[model samples]
Target: MITIDLITGFLGSGKTTFLRKYVKYLLAQGENICILENDYGAVNVDMMLISDLLGDHCDMEMVSGGCDSDCHRRRFKSKLIEMGMIGYTHVLVEPSGVFDVDEFYDSLSEEPLNRWYKAGAHITIVDAGLRLPLSDTSRYVFASEAANAGVIVFSKTQLNNPEAPSNILKYLNESLASISCRRKLKASETVAKDWNDLTDEDFKRIESAGFKTYGFEKQQVMDEHKYESLYFMEKKFSLDQIKEKASAAINDPECGGIIRIKGFFKDAEKGWMEVNVTKDDFTVAPVENGQDIVIVIGEKLGKEKLAEIFGEPAEVHAD
Candidate 1:
C-alpha cells in the first residue's frame, strides 16, 4: 500500500511552491516519492516546477481534465494502482487550483484506488498575505481542508502582515468548530511552540470566541464572487518593479474590494522575493535561490489589467 497525500488550494495560493519544498524535505529524509499533477489547462506549471526539483529521483503522472468530471478520477486511480504495482512507496497528488479536496476524497473513497492507496493527509497552501477571513468561501474551503487534515501547514507565513498570524488562527479555529471534528486544532506560535501547548490554546480560544470548532463549515460572506477574484501570474519581473506595482495597486484609491495578492519576483540584488498581499497590507521577503514565478490573487482585478499595471514581462530565465 502507498501513502497518498493530497495537496490542495485555490488558484495562485502557492501550491506549486509548497510542493517543491515538500519534495526537498522528503528527499532529505530519503523517502521514495511519486507525484501526480492534475492539470486543468493545457500548461502544467506545477508539473514543470516539480520536475525541476525532483530531477530523476521521482516519477510524475499528469491527469488532464481532472479539475472536473470523473474521467481524470478514474485515470488517476488507475495510475496509482500501476505505481503500487511497481512498488512505489509514497504518492503525492496535487489537484487543480479550482478542485476541492472534499470532492476529490469523496470521489476517490468510492473507487478501486482505495484499495491501492489510502488518503494519508491533506496539506493546503494558503497565501498569508491574502489575510482572508474564515468566512470567505475560498478560505472556508481551505480551513475545512485543514480541519480534516492530519497535519495542516500554512505556507507563506513569513510574507504575511503582523495581523495575518492571528487571523489565520481565528479562521483555523472557526473551521475546525464548524466541522464538529475538534473545536481546537493546535498550531505553532513561535515556530518553536510545543505541540501540546499549541493544541491547548486551540480549544481555549475557540470556547472563548463563541464559535463552533469542527464539522461542516459554512461559506462566509464574500464581497467578491469567483469571477471577480483578483488574479495575476507573471513569469519574471524586476523585484523593484513588482514592489512598486504592488504598492500602487494595494494603495490605489480606486482599488475597492481587492483582497488577496501573491506571487514571486526577482531582484538583481536579492535573488527572489515572494510577494503576498491581503487587504491593504503587503510583505516582500528576499528568498535564497528560487524560481521566478509570481501570482497575485486580488478582487476585481483581471490578468490583462494586472499585466498592464506590472508592465511588460522580462526575458530573464529562472535559474
Candidate 2:
C-alpha cells in the first residue's frame, strides 16, 4: 500500500513552497514518490516547479480544468493508480487553490482508489503574512482542509504577521470541535502543547471524532543540534562517507536554515543516505531502507555543494 499525502492551501498561501520542502524531505528519506497537481486554471505551475526541483526522481500528473465534477475525480484517481503501478511508494497531491477539502475527501472516501491508497496526512498551508482572519471563505477553505489533518503547517512565516498563526489555530480548533463532537476544543492552545495532555481519553475522543489527530511522537527540544530546515545539493560519496558527512553537516554552526533539511546524497556503504532532519534538531532517519534519493524537508541548512564537500562516491547511477 502507498502512503498518500494531500497538500491543501489557498492561492499564494505557500503550497508550492511547502511541497518543495516536503519533496526534499522525502527524497532525503529515500522514498520513491510521485506528485499529482490539480489546477483549477489551465496552467499547472506547481507541477512544473515540482518537476524542476525533483527532476527525474518525481513522477508528475496533472488534472486540468474542463472535466465534469465526477469525471475530474475519476481522472485524478486514475492518474494516482497509474503512478502507483509504476512502483511509486508514495503519492503527494497538491490540489488547486480553489479546491475544497471536504469534497475531495468525500470523493476519495467513496472511491475505488481508497482501497489502494491510505491517506497519510492532510497538510494545509496558510500564509502568515496575509494576516487574514479564518472567517473569510478562502481562509475558511484553508482551515476546512486542515480541520481533519494529521498535521497542519503554517508556511511563509517570514512574510506573515506575527499573530497570524495563533489566530488561524484558534479558528481551526473551534471549527474542528464544532464538526467533531468527540474531541474537546481548547482555546489558545499552541501546536507545541505537551503530548502528555493528549491522554488515552483524548485519543479515544479523537478516534471517536472520526479523525485521527495525534502529535508528532518525537521529543521537541531546542538544541544547537536541532534544525527546522536543511538543504543539501549534489552530494556524492560512499555510503559510509555520506553518513559521516551528514552527521558532520548537522553539527555545523550554520544549520539554522529551516527546522529541517531536504536534499539528495550518494552513499557508498548504504548506496544513499537520504537524510531527514526533523524538529530543528539534526536527528536523521533514512526512509525506504536507504536508497539514493533527495531530502525534501527536515531540520535546516542552506544550499551547499554537498558533492564537493563529501568525498568519493561508492557508486553512481543514471539519474
Candidate 3:
C-alpha cells in the first residue's frame, strides 16, 4: 500500500513552509509524491506558493473548499480514489488549519482507499512563538490538531525566546485537559530544531514517526461560522501599501481576531507579489504568476471594516 501522510496544524502555524522542505527531501530521495492541498476556502492560495515544486517527481492537486462538511468529505474521498489509480510513492495531505482528523482516518478506512493506502506520518507543525491567550475555540483547535501527531515539530524556534517551545507545550496540555482529552505529549515526541539546520536523520525521523489515536470530546467548531476567510480580489495595492493596511487590521480589535493575511496582488512596478502576514512574520516576495486576490483568515472577522481596509472583498467563504 502506498503511504499517505497528513501534514496538519492550526492557521498560521507554518504547515506550508514545513511541507515545502519535507517535499524537497522526499524528491531528493527519488520518491514520486503528490501533494493534496485540502483547504477550506474557495481559493487555495497556499497551493500557488508551492507551484514551483510541480514537476515529474512532485505533483500538486487540491480539494477546493466552500462546501458543507459531508459534501467536502465525499469530494475528498473521490479525489483520493482518482489519485489511487496513479502510481505515487506517497501522498501528502495538507488540510485546512481548522480540520477534523477523523475525516482522514474515516475516509481511508472505507473500501478501495483502505487497501491502496497505508497511514504514514501524522506531522503537526507548531509555531514556536504561538501567542498565548487564544480563545477556548482556538485553544481547542490547537490541542485537537496535535492530539494524534506522530511527531509535533516546532517552527521558527531560533527566532523565538528559548522558553517559547516549553511554554507552548504547557499551553497545549492545558488545552487538551480542558477538552477532556487524556493524550499528553512528551519532549521526545517533539523536535524543535530550526528547519535550516535539519539534517538527513531528522527528515528520516519525521518520515518514520507513526501516529497514535486517543479519544477526546469532539467539538463542532470546525465549521465556517467558527473561522471566517474574507477574500479581496483585484485590489491594485503595492506590497508596501498592503502591509501598512494589514498592520492596522492586526492591531485593531474591531477587525475581530484577524490572524492571517495572504494572497497575491499586482504591484505597479514589481508585477505580481505574494504576501503572507501573521503575528510573527510579515513576508512579501515576487512571484512569476498569480491571481489578483488577498485573503484574511481568523475568527468573527468584521466584513465591513475589512472591506474598508483591503477594498471590498470579492466574497467571503468558509469551508
- Top of the candidates by TM-score: 3
Clashes within 3 Å, all models in order: 21, 49, 0
Regarding lDDT, does 1 or 3 come out ahead?
Answer: 3
TM-score of each: 0.63, 0.54, 0.96
- State the lDDT of candidate 3 residue by residue for 1-319, as single tens digits: 8899999888988898899999999999889999999987888888888899999889988997645888889999999999999999899999998898999999999999999999999999999988788988899899988998999999989989888898888888888888898988888899998999998899999999989998799988855478888888877777778889899888888898887888888878888788888876898888877988888999889888877888888888764
lDDT of each: 0.56, 0.50, 0.88
lDDT comparing candidate 3 with the true structure = 0.88
Sorted on lDDT, highest at the top, how do the candidates line up? 3, 1, 2
Worst 10 residues of 3 by lDDT: 219-228
Candidate 3, residue 123: CA error in Å? 0.2
Query: How large is the C-alpha RMSD of every model relative to the true structure?
Result: 7.8, 14.3, 1.4
Candidate 1 lDDT trough over 10 residues, lowest sum: 204-213
**Model 1 misses residue 236 by how many Å?**
7.3
Q: After superposition, how far is residue 41 of candidate 2 from its true place, in Å?
A: 1.2
Best by lDDT: 3
lDDT by residue (125-237, candidate 2, tens digit) is 65444433433333334445555565455554544456666766666666555444233333322222223233444323322222345321122122122222222334443
